[model samples]
Target: MDYIANYVDAIVIGGGHAGCEAALSLARLGKKTVIFCLNIEAIAKMPCNPNIGGTSKGHLVKEIDALGGEMGKNIDKTYIQSKMLNTSKGPAVHSLRAQADKVEYHKAMLKVLDAETNLTIKQQEVSDILIENARVMGVRTITGAIYYAKAVVVCTGTYLKSKIFIGEFAENAGPDGLKSSQVLSNSLLDNGITLRRFKTGTPARVDKRTIDFTAMEAQLGDSKVVPFSFSNSAASIKKNQIQCFLTYTNEQTHQIIRDNLDRSPLYGGKIEGVGPRYCPSIEDKVVRFADKSRHQIFIEPEGVETNEMYVQGMSSSLPEEVQIQMLRSVRGLENVEVIRGGYAIEYDCINPTSLLHSLENKVISGLFFAGQINGSSGYEEAAAQGLVAGINAALKIDAKEPLIIDRAEGYIGVLIDDLVIKGTNEPYRMLTSRAEYRLLLRQDNADIRLMTKGHDIGLVPDDIYAKFLDKQEVIEAEIERIKKVFVGTTATVQSILMAKGSTPLTSGMSLHELLKRPELDYKDFAAVNLDGPELSDEIIEQIEITLKYEGYIKRQLIQVDQFKKLEKKLIPENLKYEDIKSLRIEARQKLLEIKPKSIGAASRISGVSPADISVMLVYMEQLKRTERANDASVS
Candidate 1:
């Protein structure tokens, strides 16, 4: 067969969310990049839920935006309904979730990718990763075209040997009946990459007109909107939002599910892949949580232009007849008409432990993997990995240091660390509880924590970085000024304190101290402190959070300092675990397999015990002493 040959700096396979961010990051970093997709229209497609940023996933999007990726900005532009979840809780858990017009979100992201200067989008299926001497050379497509490049990123998502199951029927297809890449899995296995089978499912989409919203609880967006992107102005994206409805499954729904349990692919021992534990199918939920009376069902709009509504919380791989039967058992969906039936998708994903913190493969120097291909489950997780992989690929090509965000730095750090070190048995999803440093990794201050790093890496523009610097200066100055400004127990101050239900000051105290009171905040003292310059809501939010959580933040910073010590203790790449006789069999085997980059990551491996880590630490110190002695003798 005649073949076409081309050359580029980077080649990105699969144009889902991960591929999009990876390609964009490379292109923006001035690398000649090409993104190959099975279908161009599926670029940035939300194959599952038509929403972005929920819980810790929201934190991931914010960090991605902070680091100059495009998910947050795109969601801000195309979201039809927006809400801040967990407002009643502390700021650490507050997440911004938005229901998007799926079509617009895809179009918006595609536009950004299209406008990128050094990027080219091609409709092709990458069949093989071309590698030489354990380093990525390029990729070959099914079309027989070979493209040579300095780096290659595989963001195949749920398309590698993808198989969809609905009841007893199964078909080899990607999401939305798209083409699946069959050859890549074999190629990956041939290249010495270990692969795992994982499955995830999506809820069915029903016609909006068929749902009786009057019977369900109406869920509305916040009256005052908050944008997800730091670059977006507060008032710019605000508009009248649409409504989502909530209903619950009754006993009848459970009965139908229970009666049809044998028919479900999951329960019938037909699904070989392990599904996500957190986002389980409706059948799985019923079987596991038998004591629960019902599960909540959310009816979300797919888009403004379409009448299709997503039947959330009811994802299953049951037969089509059973799906319709179970859905009809719900209150508002009693007469629901299904547009698309829910099904489970099983695909090939690599064992992420084979990759380093930079997301580059340990064996293949210039090869990177992101998204579901790395055993992660969500779009945000995929995009975050994509951003990191893309940035590192560009840095590697330019002979620069790779960007490695630590656990203390951001949730993205915690995510990557958990994947590369601990390794997940099933599809991994990010949660607030997973991050030990969630206090410092809040969504609101994502830019404050990551913008400078993004700017240094050339992903963030100079003007935006300058604005970020200005914002930082204002926040620091305001915090210092508040700490110095004293307030006496005067009538005005006492009255204001009483009005806010806070205890009156004993004598006098700094404004910062007053702001630290549980019931009081910077806003309550705005009238008394008339001399201070008016600050934007974003600035005020930072000031308030800093003062209120000063003690907690300081404590976390101390913990971070301790963490950095272990992370800094680099594990020699060529060090052989088999040489360490004191290590346990399991620990030695795991260490030999993973080849963790640092002591900190090694300690987190599942089978590596604390005793083993202690032995390794002692060995490392002894090794260092021996190396010094040898050098002295040679000199």
Candidate 2:
């Protein structure tokens, strides 16, 4: 058979959120990159949900934007409704979530990819990765075309040997009924990669006109919308928002699901793959949380032009007839018309432990894996991994140091560390509780934590980086001015304090000290304003957060310093864990399997104990001394 041959700097397989970011990052960095998708129309498609950024997932999107990725900016441009979640909580957990016009979101991302320099988007299925001497050489398409590159990033997402199950019926297909790549799974297994089968489901899409909106509570977008991207202007994204209806599943809905449990593929022992524990199917919820009286269901619009509405919390793999019955049992959805049936998709993913913190494969140099293929669950998680993998793949080809985001820096760091160091048994989802340094890694300050790294890596434009620096300078100057400016205990000041319900000042104090009070914020003191330049809201936010959490931030920073020490203690790539006699049998086996990059990472692994870490540290120190002695003797 005749085959076409092409060459590029990098090749990205799959065109979902992960592949889009990877391709864009590589192209922006001056690398000629090609991203192949099974269907071009599905580029950046949201198969499960028509929205982005929720809880810790928002932090990932912000970090991706800070590092010059496109998800945040795209969502901001195309969102139909936007809101800031967890407002009642501290700034650490506050997240920006937005409901997107699914079609517009895809169009916006596609436009960005199209405009990217040195990037070529192709419609093709990648069948196998080519390797030589355990290093990635390129990838071959199913059509017999070979694409040779310096590096190959597999962002296949949930398409590798994918199977969709709806009750007793099963078919080899990807999300939204797209063709699955059947040959890739075999190719991956043949290349010494350990593959795991994982399952995830999407809720049915119903016609909006059929839903009884008055019967359900109306959920409106925030009047003041918060943009996800630091670079995006909040004013530009603010607009009249759409409404999402909230409905609940009652005893009748539960009874229907309970009666159909035996018919579900999940309960029938038909699904071999492990599904996500956090985002479970309706059947799982009915059985597990049986004590609960009801479950919340969100009816979200798919797009402005379409009548399709996503049934948010009712993801299931029930039979088509049962699904309709299940939908009708709910309050507002009593007469709902189903547009698309919910189903479970099982796909082959590589064991994330096979990769390094940089997201590059340990055995196959220049090869990278991201997205669901890494066992992660959300679009944000996949995009974050894709950005890291793309950046590191380009760095490797350029003979530069690979970029690794540590746990304390951002949610991206915590996510990669958890995946590569502490491998997930099921599909992993990022949560605020997973990150110990959430205060320091807040979504609001993602730019502050990562923009400089992006600039240093050549992804951030010089002008944008200069703007970030200017914002930082303004924040610092305002903080200093506030600390020095003393407010007298005059009648006017006391009255202002009294109006704010704050305690009257007994003596004169710096404005900074007053700002530290729980009830008083920077804006509250405008009545007795001190001299300072007017600042952007962004700058003021940073100043306020820094002052308000100064004590807690300091403590976390101290913890970060301690963490840095262990992280700096690098484990030798060639070190033999089997040779350590003091290590427990399980610890040795786990260590050999994971081959952690540092002492900090090793300590986080489940089976590895504190005693194992201590023994490994001592052995490392002895090895260093032996190497030093040998060098001296040779001299």
Candidate 3:
């Protein structure tokens, strides 16, 4: 017997990183939202890596914050250690990564969700998404309670009929021994949602007391912490950081894994899902890179409260005995006791091509999908999708235009565009290389790029938006001031330049030009002028980057303009690609299947070539001419 329980404007399934962000976004936008999870304690749980943000992923987190998402803010509150990566490279690649206290992070997010007046958190597994006439009605719980909603966002992170495997042993469970949603797969399949089996694994957690830290190199966090959130500052969130250790795997470790290849489920053909190519398991890495003698591994603390340490680069699904043998072969982990052995978990995820750029299903009007359910890996990627999906779902209810961030806008846009167009065969991970205009889509300037959009969508608060606007104004003013502030070829200027290891000025130069020098930086200006605007580190960074990369930025902007033109060449929804006689059979098939919204999107499809794009442009022009002729004849 099914019972009517409650009603809400929207329902978000799965309380993982994606679910938290989606529910919060929907609720904050004045929509009454209810989030369902198998267990309340699992809300925003870091089931795999006990860290957030890395390389390109940091850009996503900053963009998420810029767009009024909770991840960056929550991470700022609960991170145990913080470090900026790729500092030796250009500013474009500089990314902020933080080690999170997994337990505390979860609690902090739950607190935020609890405080949201329009949001409800329920510890119940959603068994079915009730649909009527190709639109979402609500979801039915496992206990046969029907909760109605105008929209539903599925964020089921690795819990849809998930099964964990270790050697030949397997169990029906989610990450960290959580209950898997077994019946929901059928519901999704019945609703015509195509599902794919994808696999991802996590490394073992070793008992901290049993590990030998002396044999490992101590990895320290940055002395001056960098916060992930744009709303936060270095001074505001300073604290004593925790220590992580670095170790490596030797020939012995490799030998053990190679010898036990037959016992490994992945190699033995016991696991059917395709694993991530980038983040492979230990055995897979050793097998794939046979020439490599050693692999780097980081031993990181899970949290301050727990005595378990996460083995960073050593994800495996070998048997317990083999895992023990593998661990003992490593240097510092020679005698380390395993608190939890690593295993790979396979789950059902949808082919992201079925989703629109807004993350809404094309077949089902009010159905949205985000996170791992969209075949994307990593917490940051999941959160980015969640925020967009949540905002779009709310906009749909409000009868407003759906927010669509194009490739030229932010990394979030690039992430979605790739997933929607290319459609990954394996779990998709965000990479800086994936973004074409990475110079414009930097982590530091995420707020400048997308905060306005976030504010216009009713997600960013007025106070925060005001702060962002003020920062923008100050940065612009400072850049203008610097460009006009002339420095003469005085002895004082030469000495200062010489001391800073920069080429002595041959003639008068502006502060902006001085900053462009390879050896000179904005900080060196303190010696030149004491009267310079008292600016925060953030503002100074923006000014320096803007001046240093002015030429490159301008070039990218021009490229972006070209990209946007193709993006603006909208494809008519009803246009039959089969009618375009010039298109190749594969191109026509792909175009018909994808039904891309723009020429730019269609061009990105794997099978669609440049020649096909030219054909499309011609056909569109022909169609326009025919329409114009028809109008003229009627007149």
Candidate 4:
């Protein structure tokens, strides 16, 4: 028997968030790319949550959009309800979140993938990677067909030997009863790739008809919707949105969960995976916070056209009967009929430390990994890694320089750096709190921070890059004008302040200074007229933030300068750390184990300290001196 032969510039294993983005990016960059999945209809499926973007996840979506990825545009076109979370707080925390039409999201993404000129979507399970020596040659599907490629990105998210459990019942299945790739897992293990099992749960989908709206409070989306895509005109896409409901899990609901704790796979020793700490099961929440009498459960619409409502904050793997019992016990859900029973899924994930900063395996060239396969937990997190992996893989194929986002630059940089440098014991998820420089990495400025990189990588179009340049110029011009323009304590200014409920200024100050006031802002000073600088709202956003957080931003900039110095100090790949006598045992062991590319990456490793960094610096200097002496002698 003969098998078919396929060839492509790049191959992506898996068709979820990471795989979709990675394959699409590679194809969009004009590379011939093939994406293998169990089923094409399951492409870009949101198995766990019906929505996209929340808090820092929103920042990732926007950054993905700026880089010419499909997630933001797909969500923007399909979202039923949209919201800007944390609006009451500072602008730094403000994030755009939306409830996407799940079915439509999948359809829209598949359409883009299918219509792309250089991309092919395949329905097959990849069983093993074809490796020549230590470098990835390509992948072999279960049907025994070999497809050769220059690079292969393994984004096999939560489907490798996946098992779903509900109470005492368990079966091999990917999330949502999809086909699980069980054979490919042992193939990876045989090839020396270690596996770590992680667990994630989805909430029950309830029939909207059975829900009692009168007993629950209505949660509405924000009147003004913000599109996640940078390419979108922002104004043209705005429209009327859907509403979500809010219900509470009372003490009765807790009692039902407590009564069946023994039956839960997580509580029982049935699950052998590390679950996400941030998103816990309802059982975990009830047990962990026993003192609390109630917990909030969001009734999120799965889609505007569908009758299924997602039970957020209530994910579990209780038995089907228990699931129904638990749902009915919640206030306003007395008659709820579950469209689908919730369950916990345990699947294989790799230790991210096994990969390099470029998301490629250090031990195996041309072999790359991203998303849940790297032990990350969110759709946004997965997509971010996919974008980076795809970009780097494409660059590798073309002999161009790989893209690297540093920890100080954007959240994507911080996320990948953390994954590679400080490997996680649990499934990794992105949070604003994870980055010290989050204020500088807000969603509003993601395009500005990452668009240039995208442009350089050939994903961002030249016209879009030019537009970004124009926007930057306008922002800088406005800031300059504001700094040069001065305002006096005139009645006009005083009246404006009073009207806006701000304290009246006793003395004159620069327009920039006035804008920096916590009580007074650029919009508040509309009553005062000056020709020095007139800013549009979007442009003023950048100016106001820079002026307001000038001190913090400057301090972070200094920190970044120090970071750059260390990052600039390149560590030779073949250097023998064991020969360095001055380095500490722990530091040397860590440096050799992680094989950090730079002194900066070495420092981020957990056990390595400042003293260790200093020691390494001195050792590197000595090596440089010895090298120079040898070169002089040779001359």
Let me know the TM-score candidate 2 reaches against the reference structure. Answer: 0.98
lDDT of 1 by residue, 1-635 (tens): 72657899999998999999999999999999999999999999998999999999999999999999999999999999999999999999999999999999999999999999999999988888998899998988888899999999999999999999999999999998889999999999999999999999998999998989999999999987888888888699998789999999988999999999999999999989999999999999899999999999999999999999988899999999999999999999889999999999999999999898999999899999998999999999999999999999999999999999989999999999999999999999999999998999999999989998999998888888889999999999999888888999999999999998988888999998888887887878877898788898889989989988999999999999989999899998878788998999999989888888789889989999999999999998899999999999999
lDDT of 3 by residue, 47-136 (tens): 899899999999999999999999999999999999999999998899999999999999999999999999998999888999999989
Residue-wise C-alpha lDDT for candidate 4, range 1-635, written one tens digit per residue: 32657878999999999999999889988899999999888899999887899989999999998888889999988988889999889877899999989999999999989899999989998988988899888988878898999999999899999999988889999989999998988878987889988989999999999988888899898876778987776586787788888888988899999999998889999999988899999999999999999999999888878899999999999999999999999888998899999999999988898888889898888889999999899999999999999989998888887888887778899899999999998888899899878878899998988898788778889987898899899888878777777788999888888887878888988888788777667876665644745655667778888888898889988888888998998998778888888788988888887899888899899889999889888888888999999999999
In order, candidate lDDTs are: 0.93, 0.92, 0.93, 0.89
**How does candidate 4 score on lDDT?**
0.89
Error of 4 at 37 (Å): 0.9
In terms of TM-score, which candidate is strongest?
3
Model 3 residue 143 distance off true place after TM-score fit, in angstroms: 1.2
**Residue 537 accuracy (lDDT) in model 2:** 78
Best to worst by TM-score, what's the order? 3, 1, 2, 4
Model 3 lDDT at residue 56: 96
Pick out the ten consecutive residues of candidate 2 with the lowest summed lDDT: 523-532
Which regions of candidate 1 fall more than 4 Å away from where they truly are?
631-635
5-116 per-residue lDDT for model 2 (tens digits): 8889999999999999999999999999999999998999999998999999999999998998889999999999988899999999999899999999999999999998
Q: Each model's TM-score?
A: 0.98, 0.98, 0.99, 0.96
Output the worst ten-in-a-row residue range by lDDT, candidate 3: 522-531
Residue clash pairs of candidate 4: none
Clashes of 4: 0
